[model samples]
Target: MTGVVRLRAVDIEDLRVVSALLQDAIIPIADMAFLPDAQQFVMLASRFQWEGRAPEDGPTPDDGAEAATRINCAVHFSGVTAVRRRGVDLRQRGAFLSLLALEPSEGALLLRLSGGADIRLEGGAIECRLSDRGDPWPVPARPDHGLD
Candidate 1:
């Protein structure tokens, strides 16, 4: 059966889990794309504002400093909050997975196991799949720009 899941804001706690998941699911796929010293990867899943940053003023100097010190640019497997759906298997449960950051224009995003792993972006209507057979995750195509 089909279901709906919504992704909310992500926090430090969530980042912990996302980090592990990213290591498990993304590292082998990314291979040398990431640096060995890099502890995290920045991710832009949807539009979300930093707690202290205002819509008008942007991020503070402290934000930048903190991010830089903590390898903030990287996106880790933030965390998972589940919504059980009857008849769905253990691997197919609905979840609101967290990401580090995303452009404001992209709305909400959901992560679920559909065959392998899938990232479903709301407004963009984009679905990215990571092959279970150990293939790399498929990057979503960017929307048209100047041509449009």
Candidate 2:
């Protein structure tokens, strides 16, 4: 329970916060689900803990074997009428997607992923929550977007 985060988003401004928190999150293909009957969509993600650290204080393997942290998080979206995928293959087993951003689209919320994959969640309004699930774990490296 290292700095657990619980956030509820109902608008674009709040979603920006959630998006930043979820940036660089890794999600397994099998961990996502959409329940039409419940009008909800859910997914589990391994998110990098990006708070309380300076921009330059990133993991440096060659410096002194520095370690970073990652935590399991659960993301839930209610009032979801439909879920659509683009450039993603659901049949791929053991595949993972890196989340880049979550933004509001024309008639839905878009989850932009790495490798040009995206998920569109269409519904009446945005009602999303992100909660940390368990203890954080050490990871050797931080996610690099090659932005140097």
Candidate 3:
């Protein structure tokens, strides 16, 4: 995938793919929106390029021969009947959060973020799309979870 990344998710399995790609993505508070009239929830994230990473490269960029890359991506979920935010301060426009996962719980889609923050969407069905908005750039380091 040399060009822009585009993905669609209509089910849990497909969402797993999108979730994996967006893991560790950085999202600014000001970049999120919930359009009630449109029944949509959208957010822009600076996502780490995890697709091409080699298994032998280990975790950090320092352990690999290639530098880590990041790109801006826009994600949207349609058919969102309701949205609930927790542990997120919408007033903190400058604050950012790291994406942890996207999972289904009790028929709702949950966007797990760092610092125990979360945004949950409830609706009839899950329809999510992610598209890269700009060129990818090399990042100095990869996100470390201390799992090693």
Candidate 4:
């Protein structure tokens, strides 16, 4: 069902699918937390679309149909992870989490974050699930200003 996306595979394609879901999402930093001690990065995000459209190509939140398709997502990546953040402060609130790129490296999944930073997780075993909540994804008060 489109309303509920369950992905449990630990494969390259799985990572890509998860990446696609998170593409162009404006995730709050408070909704994300990285536990270096546990080697896990957990995030709750409101993903506008998982159709893999470019940010500019995706429907605006004003588009009622597409906006209703938005899903609240949860992503979890674990296994001997290492994080390197560049040009993004963990202190930032309501930051946009642009998944710049995803690829296979050293037998692991490499997540290229926006601002030239990256996170490498030990297996491609990233888990992502999605569901449409009672309400649609909230549009920012200012156009495009939601980006951090």
Candidate 5:
């Protein structure tokens, strides 16, 4: 298909799309130790928290509190674009995305680029390259205990 493919920064609204793509792209390879439901829940929680969504009360401890914290520190850029970079490994199952946040006179923006051909934990860091379309924005990092 031929069309306008513009590259810009990321934003808050893009979180859902990025999260869904990451989850859909990763599930096939995630370790069988985790039930499908658990995997989906984790993915949704991560995406929702990142997108500033209120947490739902669950049987787990402090779930609501943690979700609130994540929502508070969330950040995003304005423009966004994506392209297939390389082949992904489907053997490993985990969601990994590189996000960049920026702020300009217009508004805040967030960019989320998905990697891994299938489902695998690929080591990478968030890259921020200033573009004419957006300015860099800082997102406060929230404290995560690595627990549910």
Candidate 6:
């Protein structure tokens, strides 16, 4: 996790790398903000926070200190040329992110939320910073073992 996990889509495989790099990122709609004039969208994400959480699944009794410390990061997409969506109402702030997809053809990205909301950005550069004011995220290696 030293160098940036940056991937520019010169081919389809590059997009797959970006997809794998963003595995299991949870985004609360309440923390999302989009600036139309600047053509930028930002979202605060809790990485490794898998979907389908139950009330009892929160910080466990014997979990380590990091259990309570969610790794929140800022994800920014800039230079958006156009945007389109369906079943999305930005006013409501109680949804969770289900997916983030990048289109190789148009260099755009799509954000799919839990409530069947799909926001499509036609053109932008995407990057995520692990800390509030730190540099871009470093590339992650795929784990060889499953959740133990």
lDDT of each: 0.27, 0.88, 0.89, 0.58, 0.27, 0.53
**What order do candidates take by lDDT, descending?**
3, 2, 4, 6, 1, 5
List the candidates' TM-scores in order: 0.17, 0.88, 0.91, 0.63, 0.20, 0.54
lDDT per residue for candidate 4 within 62-133, as digits (tens), equals 433332345677777666466555566777785666656566677466667666766565643444344334
Which lDDT tens digits does candidate 6 get at residues 64-117? Answer: 222222245666666666777778666668977755444444576666544566
Q: What is the C-alpha RMSD of each candidate to the true structure, in Å?
A: 16.4, 3.5, 2.5, 6.0, 16.2, 9.4
Decide which is better by TM-score, 3 or 5. Answer: 3
Q: Please, what are the lDDT tens digits per residue for candidate 3 over residues 60-108?
A: 3346556788999999999898999899989999999899999887778
Q: Candidate 6: misplaced stretches above 4 Å?
A: 1-15, 49-70, 113-116, 124-148
Error of 4 at 52 (Å): 10
Q: After superposition, how far is residue 36 of candidate 5 from its true place, in Å?
A: 21
Can you give the lDDT of residue 75 in candidate 4? Answer: 71
Q: lDDT: which candidate is best?
A: 3
Residue 19: error of model 1 in Å?
Answer: 18
Stretches of candidate 1 off by over 4 Å are 1-72, 81-118, 121-144
- Candidate 3 has a TM-score of 0.91
Ranking by TM-score: 3, 2, 4, 6, 5, 1
Model 6 poorest ten-residue lDDT run: 61-70
lDDT of 2 at 112: 99
Scored against the true structure, residue 36 in model 3 reaches a CA lDDT of 93
Instruction: Give the per-residue lDDT digits (tens) of candidate 2, residues 1-148.
Output: 2478999999999999999889999999999999999999999999988763443555533232335788999999998999999988989858999999998987799999998989999997869999999888988887888877
Tens digits of per-residue lDDT, candidate 1, 64-138, equal: 322211111223322212212222233433433333222222343443322344443333232222112211222
The better-scoring model by lDDT among 5 and 6 is 6
